[model samples]
Target: MLAIKGVSRRFGGKTAVADVNLEIAPGAFIGVIGRSGAGKSTLLRMLNRLVDPSEGTISFDGVDVTALRGQALRDWRARCAMIFQQFNLIGRLDVLTNVLMGRLNKVSTASAVLQLWGLEDKAMALAALEQFDIANLAGQRADSLSGGQQQRVAIARALVQEPSIILADEPIASLDPRNTKVVMDALLRINKHFGITVICNLHSLDLARGYCDRLIGMSAGRVVFDGAPAALTADAARDLYGLEAGEVMDADADVKWAGQARPASAAA
Candidate 1:
């Protein structure tokens, strides 16, 4: 459903993403994993046109995303929603109102402003909250909720747009282990049940292996590995992470949380 070819991004003389090519199929759950400064976030931003690539092309469902302008760009962005690591909720607005903000593209600015008084937009917003089990908090301010609740609220907001693809950049970076699992479960459920294409940037190899069907590992400013999670081995991970195989294997409990036994393909 999404294709990125020969995409590159540069900041002054340094390149952040170089010659990256990827194809994400419909209903696929793909994870982009790498160390800091590996260009994972830059690549994700380019996919949604949040950051214009310095070179090459990005197409979504056959339309050249780079070619869109004004209303066309706005519409394209609406179809491809993004979820940030930070909840990005409007602190003063009630949870429902914050979620309703997702539909601002579809409604006039005037109608959006008046949405707080239980209008048709309120109903639409409530429906979105219900999807994430946040309906009970509709009337409460977004800042009043816990981190997990806030993230769910953000996800509901993204869902309100009915996006065909969701780009989440380190969506669990701020959460605790429990909250991380909650957020990841919600994302996986969305992909499995609703068939929305999901591309997540994650730092945890185990989390990527556990939640994503395929993994894309980046090193420096280039894609070093792109394959099934089961295809990532200790040696391959060492190379991707730029460390000794044993060192990479022993780095974090979570990174090795999948189990003592490695997948047969990855073991090879």
Candidate 2:
């Protein structure tokens, strides 16, 4: 289980996430839905130590995740993989190379710096790509692939980390509807098949309802709702998103909360 207790993140004087608490059961698929700047991304980053919380503690199982340092922090990050809105692949490198980068914490610095990955490591990276049905593109440059394909490669990279939890910060924000389905399905498969916990930041209520078993709604950096997807009614969505029933169900409405510019797949 992942436990977040009294967690908060402050940017200068502004609190991005505030006094939040959550318990994530193992292997659960959770979609965190909220307007932009609601601190959805900040919450996920705190789990991976990408950002330190201004207050409170986060623990995985019984380990003190917030206190991890140096090698311990790196190991914690390996155990808790993160995927981002941008694919974050090394654009100049081949897909397989980028996936192999997941093993950096486990491998020697010399080997990584020299790009001297062993044949077994190479095979494992290939296997990860194959798991995502992208093995044939392993030799292709990451920058050459379509957005959906790059996202899959990113997931494959995370899989190579053998993480217990995957925190995806708007993984589908840039993809079209077709690509969104592809990426979301891949994440679902990873969660269900591998028993890896998944916490996703999502923009589309329909997509969140369709994919996540549980939904967490955030507003003003606090969790306003947490329940099964089926319980998120039109009224609940309205409260979460400040949208009326028609706008909530439009499916193609711009949900750029907090006046942020919508992504290319704003209609997603």
Candidate 3:
């Protein structure tokens, strides 16, 4: 489990995340929801240590991850993989090679720099590709693939890391509705089958409601609501999303999607 205590992040004079506290349990699918500038991305980046907190600490299994540095930091990053809205693969690299980059944190610098992967590493990457049903595209360049294909490739890359936790920052924000379902279903499979804790930042309430067991709402950079998706009332959503709460509350109001009305787990 991971514990976030009074965590906050600021950029110059502006605060991006403020005094947020939450405990993330294992094998849980939790969605952080809010409109733009709500600090959801900042929260995930802090968890992955891509951005250091301005105050407070984040600990995993009783160790203060905020204090980790050098090799320890690298190792922690490998254990905590991140999936971004924009698929962050090297455009020039083949899909298989892009996925093998996940193993770089665990390999020697010489091997990594030379792109010399072991048979086992190649096999693992290939298997991850196959898991996402993208094995045939392994030889294709990342930039040449469609957006959905690229995102799946990104997910496969994250899977090859063998992470204990995955922090997805708007993984489906840029995809079409069909691709959105595909990506969300893929994340659900990862969380359920592999028992990896997945904390994702999402904008669509229907998608979040359908896939995530718990939903955490943010407003003005602080957590305002944290509970089950069904427990998230329209009133609470109003506080989370302001005028757009109507969209957040009514799943079918502005969007047409088959991803609504899924059951969620009991609150942790």
Candidate 4:
């Protein structure tokens, strides 16, 4: 379990996140929804220690996240992987090489710097690519692929890390609708099939409703609502966004608001 207690983050004089507390069970697919500058990104960053909280504690199982340093912190980062909106791949590197970077923490610094991957490491990276149906693109440059394909490569890289948790910060924000579906489907598959806990920051309420098992609504750096998608009413959405939920409902026409059980085929 991931436990966050009274967490807060401050940048200069302004607070990015304030007094947040949450207990996330293992294997959960959680969607974090909020308007821009609502501290959604800050919250996720704090989990992986990319950004340290000014106050409170974050724990995974019994480990205290705040006190970790050096190699321990690096190990923690490997366990709690982060997926970014920009896909963060080395544009000039081949897809397979980029995926192999996930093993940096496990390998010696000299070997990693020299790019000396062994046959087993290469096989693991290839297997991760094949799991995402992108093994054929292993030899291709990461920048040469489409947005959806690049994102899949990013996911494959995360898979090679063998993370216990995945924190995606607005992962589909830059993609078109078709690419959005593809990336979201990949995340859903990772969460359901691998039993890895996923917490994604999303701009679209409909996508959150369709893909996430639980929705966490934030407003002005505070959590406003936490529950199932069906329980999030139009009024509650309005609280998150000044605009009514109806205006956003059409963003993804196929996503229903009634919180029906997502079909297995959706992830497949």
Candidate 5:
């Protein structure tokens, strides 16, 4: 569904992403992991044209995404929705209203500003909330919800757009363990049930291994590994993080928010 070839991004002299190549098939759940400055977020943003590549090309369903502009670009972005680490909801708006904002591209700016107060949009928004199990909070202000609830609402908002592909950049970064489970479960369920293509940037290897069908590891702005989650090893992880296998194993045995638990066979 998505293909990135020889993609590179530079901010002035600093290259955030370099010569990255990846292909995502329909209904695939792919996870990207890397250190703080490894360019995972930059790569995710480039998928939907949030950041145009400094060099190389990105294509979606065979259409060259970097070449898109004007209405064409907007239309393409609508098909590939993004979820941020922060739940980017309007604080004052009701949860349902915030979710309905996903449809803004389909409606006029005036209508969206007024929230298109009608039964149809309301029904669609409520259905989206129901999917995320936040239907009861539909009328409440976005700011009133807990972190987990807010994130679920944000997912609902993205789902409301009926996007063919979802790009989530550290979606569960701020949640506790239990909340992380809830959010990851929701994402997994969506991928399994709806067959939506999901590519997410995650910090935790455990979470990526547990939930994603495939993992892509990055270091210093380049992809170092791309394969099934089961293929990852302590040695590979050590190389990715520039640590010894023992050091990587010793630090934080407990699962971090998005961390994956090592499989029995791979455990040290």
Candidate 6:
């Protein structure tokens, strides 16, 4: 289990995340929802150690994740992979090379710098691309693919890392409707087929409702609601968004509240 106790993050005078606690089990699909700047990104960054917590502890299984350093920290990062909104990839490199980069931490620095990928590594990367139905694009430049294809490359790269958990920060925010559905389906497949825990930050309540087994609602850096999607009542949503629940319902065709917390999901 992944356990967080009293976790918080602050930047100068601003508290990005505050006194947050959660226990996430393996193979669970969790969706985190909140308005922009409500600490959702900061929370995920802290989990991957891209940002350090101001106070509290995070533990994975029996290990103390907060105390990892140097190689240990790098190892921790490998175990907990992060997929970004922009689909971070080496645009100049071939898709295969970009996927091979996921093994950098496991290889010697000299070998990695020299780009000495063994046959086994190439096979591994090829297999990952095949899993995403992108093996044909292996020889193509990463920037040459469509947005949806590039996002698939990013997911394949994460798979090559063999991570036990994936933290996706607005992964489908930039994709079109068709691609959004594809990406969400890919994430679901990874979680179900491989038993990898997935914690995603999402802006679309519709996508959250459709893809997530459980939802977490945050307001002003604190968790306001946590339960199965069906348990999220109208009153709970009001407290979560500080507005009438209907205002942010993604299914509402006429919703255009100034505080548009949830928009219609591209996946829908």
The whole-model lDDT of each prediction reads: 0.83, 0.89, 0.89, 0.89, 0.85, 0.86
- Clashing residue pairs in candidate 3 (N, C-alpha, C atoms within 3 angstroms): none
RMSD of each: 4.0, 6.0, 2.6, 2.9, 3.8, 5.1
Give the TM-score comparing model 2 with the true structure, all chains together.
0.92
Superposed model 4: Cα runs more than 4 Å off: 244-247, 255-268
Residues 1-268 of candidate 5 have per-residue lDDT tens digits of: 6889999999999999999988889999998987888999999899889899999999988899999999899988888999999999999988888988888778887887776656776788898788878899988999999999999998888887788998899999999977887898878777878889899998877777768888899999999999987788877888887753343343453435336543322242
Between candidates 1 and 4, the one scoring higher on lDDT is 4
Local error of candidate 3 at 142, Å? 0.7
Residue 62, model 3: lDDT of 96
Pick by lDDT: 2 or 6, better one: 2
* Candidate 4 residue lDDT tens string, 142-196: 9999999999998888888899999999999899977887788889889989999
Instruction: State the local distance difference test value for candidate 3.
Output: 0.89
TM-score of each: 0.89, 0.92, 0.94, 0.94, 0.91, 0.91
Which regions in candidate 2 have their CA more than 4 angstroms from the true location? 244-268
Worst 10 residues of 6 by lDDT: 258-267
Q: What lDDT does candidate 5 reach at residue 225?
A: 93
By TM-score, how accurate is candidate 4? 0.94
| Residues forming the 10-long window of minimal summed lDDT in candidate 1 | 259-268
- On lDDT, who's better, 4 or 5? 4
Cα RMSD of predicted structure 3: 2.6
Query: Candidate 1 on 1-268: residue-level lDDT in tens?
Result: 6888999999999999999988889988899988889999999888778899999999988999988889999888888899999889999988888888888888877776776343666777787777777799988999999998999899888887888998899999999977787788788878877899889998877777777889999998899999998789877887888753443343464454364443322233
Off by over 4 Å in 6: 243-248, 252-268
